[model samples]
Target: MSVYARRRRRSGTLMELVLTFVALGLLALLTLSGIARQSAGEPILPWIQPSSGNHLPHGVNYQIDALDPTTLAPMATLPQKGMVELRLAVTNDSALPVTFSFPTSMQCEFVARKVHTYVGGLFVLPLEVWRSSYFHNVSRHASRLTLNPAQTKVYVANWTLDPFDTGEASAGTYQVSASFGKSTIPLHIDKPL
Candidate 1:
C-alpha cells in the first residue's frame, strides 16, 4: 500500500441541502404573499379613487389627485383645509422601462397659492403661497429610480393646513400644484375636498 492514504471525496451534507431548500421556499412564500395582497385589492394605498387628469406625455405621464385625510379615500372636490393628502402618481407608458434621477429622496414638490380673482373670472392673481412643501428629504444625495413598462408609482404627501397660519389659504380657492421632474400640474384647491 502507498504511504499516503486516499481520502474519500466530500459531498454536501444533508443539513446544507435542507437549509438551502428552506431558504428558497421562504423567499417564494414572501414574494407570493406580497403579490396576493396587491391582487386581492387590499387597502394598500392611502387613496382609493381613480385619477382625474393625466399628463399625456409620450414616454411617461403624471397624475395628481386629492385624498380625504381621515378615510384615505379619493376626494373629488377641492382639498379642504386642515390635514390634507395629495396623491402623486407617475406612470411609465413607454414600451421600455423609464428611469428618473432625483436630487433627493423627495421625489416631488408641492405648493398651493391663494388665487385672487378680481372682477369675477377676469383678472387672476396668485397671492401668498401656503402648504408650500418644497423639501421633504433634505439630503444632498442623489437617487435613481426605474419604472418598468406599465408601472405606476404613487407617493402620498401630507401637510397640515391652517388658514390661521397664512390668511391666504383660508376656506377659499387656491392653485395647488406639484412638480415632478420637469413637469408641473396645477389644480384648483377649493373647499370640502
Candidate 2:
C-alpha cells in the first residue's frame, strides 16, 4: 500500500474511535441526569416514606392509652414479680399517609423520676423505676413505619414491675413520661412499711 493511503486509513480509524468515545460520554451524561431528576426529592430508600424532619405530622394522633387500674399497687416485697403493658396507639388522622422515622429500633422510652417532698417540688430525684429500654428486647434497626389515613397501630412494651410501682425502690410520687409522643402522667406510690 502507498504510505499516504496507509496514513489516511490510520487517521480515519483514530477519528472513529475518538468520535465513539464522545458519543458514549454524552449518552452517559444524559442517562445520569435523568436518574437524578427522578430521585431529586426522595431519600435513598424510596419505598420507605420519610417524615418531616424531627417533627411528627400535626394531624397524626400518637398517645398512650390510659394506664390500667389507674393506681399503683403497693408491692409486698422487693423486685415485685409484676408487669405493666405500655400501649402507644398511633392514629393517622390526615388524609395523606403519615410516616414515623425512628432513628433506633426503639419506638419510645418510658421514664419515671421520683419527686421528693422534702424539697417541695424543687428537687426531683432522678430514679427510673421501670425502663423499657432495659427490659424490652427488640431487633435493632433504623426504620420507618408508615400509616394510611384513619389507620391506627399500637406498639406495646411489657414492663416487669408493679402497676405505678416497682417495689421499695419506687415509693413516692413519680413524674412519669414517655420519650416519644411526649406525655407526662403523675403516679403516687405508697411508701413501703
Candidate 3:
C-alpha cells in the first residue's frame, strides 16, 4: 500500500476509536442518571397489620377501647356540648417493664377530631387534643409512658363536641373515628338537634 494511503487508513481507525469511547461514556452517564432517579422516587411503605393478640417484640401491647358515654350519660346526643371518653389500654405482655413513646398521629382511612390523655401511672396528665385549622381549637397532646410486665395502663381521651360547631357540615350523620397506631375505634355523631 502507498504510505499516504496507509496513514489515511490509520487516521480513520483512530477517529472511530474516539467516537466509540465518547458514545460509551454518554451511555454510562445516562444509566447512572436513571438509577439516581429511581432511588430518589418515593419509597413504598409496608402496610401495618393489626395485632392478633400477639405481643410486640418489645413486650408492649397497644389497644384502644371506647368508653360508652351511654353508661354514664346516654352517649351524649349530637351537639349536646359534652365530652366523649375513650380509653386506650397499654399493657406489657413481656416479662419486663417496657417504656413506650407515643407518636403524634396514626395513619387511617378517615378524618376526625382527636385528643389524648395519659392516666393510671406516673405519667398521668390532662387530655390533649390534636389541633388543626380544619377543626375547632383543640390541643392534641401525648406523654411518655412506662408499664411493668403484666401491667395494664389506661389512657383516657376526651372528645369534645361543640353544639354550634357541627364541624362546618350540614345536619347529617357523621362517623367520627379515632386511632392510635394500628388500633382504631369509631363513634357515631348525629347531626345537630
Candidate 4:
C-alpha cells in the first residue's frame, strides 16, 4: 500500500476508537444517575425483605415465646382489672449472634366496654393497679438485649386494666405485635372473663 493511504487508515481507526470510548463513558454516567434517582429515599435490596418471617438479613433465626401471665397458666382465667404479668423469650436459633431492637407498643385493646368496666370497678385499689404498673415501668428498660449464638433472653411486658379507666376489654381477641427495624411478629391475646 502507498504510505499516504496507510497513514490515513491508521488515523481513521484511532478516531473511531475514541468515539467508542466516549459513548461508553456517557452510558455509564446515565446508568449511575438513574440508580441514584431510584434510591432517593431508601436503598432497596431485591433479595432482602425486612418484614419476612423471623429470618434476619444475615441468616439469623429468632424465636418469640407465647405470653404467659405470671400468676395463671397459659389458658387460665383471671380478673379483668388485675395485673397480667407476661414474659417474652427470644432465642437465637442460628450459629451466629444477632443484635436487634424491640417494639415498645405490642398490646392492643379490642373490647372497649370490658376495658372500661374493669378500669372503673376493679382497678380502683392502688395496690391492685400497681401490679399492672410494674410491667410497664420496667419494660421500658428491659429491651435492647443482645444474644450470642444459641443464647436466649426474656423480656417482660405487663398489661394492666384499671377499674375506673375503662371497661373490662371484651372476651373476644387482641394482638401483641413485636417489631425490630422493618421486621414484626404479631401474637394473639385472648381476654379472660
Query: What is the lDDT for 53 in model 1?
Result: 35
Please write out the lDDT profile of model 1 over residues 80-187, one tens digit for every residue.
356778778888989998788877766677777666544333334566465445543366788778899999998777766664665434566766677676556676
Judge candidate 4 at residue 46 and give its lDDT: 24
| Deviating ranges (above 4 Å) for candidate 4 | 1-69, 76-79, 101-145
lDDT per model vs. reference? 0.63, 0.55, 0.48, 0.46
User: For residues 1-193, could you state the per-residue lDDT of candidate 4 as single tens digits?
Assistant: 9999999999999999999999999888556544542322112322333233343446444444333366345534434665555554556777877777545442211111112212222211111122223333434433454678777665555566555757644454343444444544444445665
**TM-score, one value per model:** 0.59, 0.51, 0.37, 0.42
**Candidate 4, which ten residues in sequence have the lowest lDDT sum?**
108-117
Which lDDT value does model 3 have at 26? 82
Best by lDDT: 1
Tens-place lDDT per residue, model 2, 1-193, is 9999999999999999999999999888655544442323222233445332224567876665424333543332323335555566778999999877776777666665454432232222345566667756777678777889999987666555556553544544544445553333223334333
lDDT of predicted model 1: 0.63
Residue clash pairs of candidate 2: none
Q: What would the TM-score be for candidate 4 when compared with the true structure? A: 0.42
- lDDT per residue, candidate 3, 83-125, as tens digits? 5555556677999877655553322222343221122211211
Ranking of all candidate structures by their TM-score, best first: 1, 2, 4, 3
Number of colliding residue pairs in each model: 1, 0, 4, 20
Give the Å error, residue 108, model 2.
2.3
Clash number for candidate 3: 4
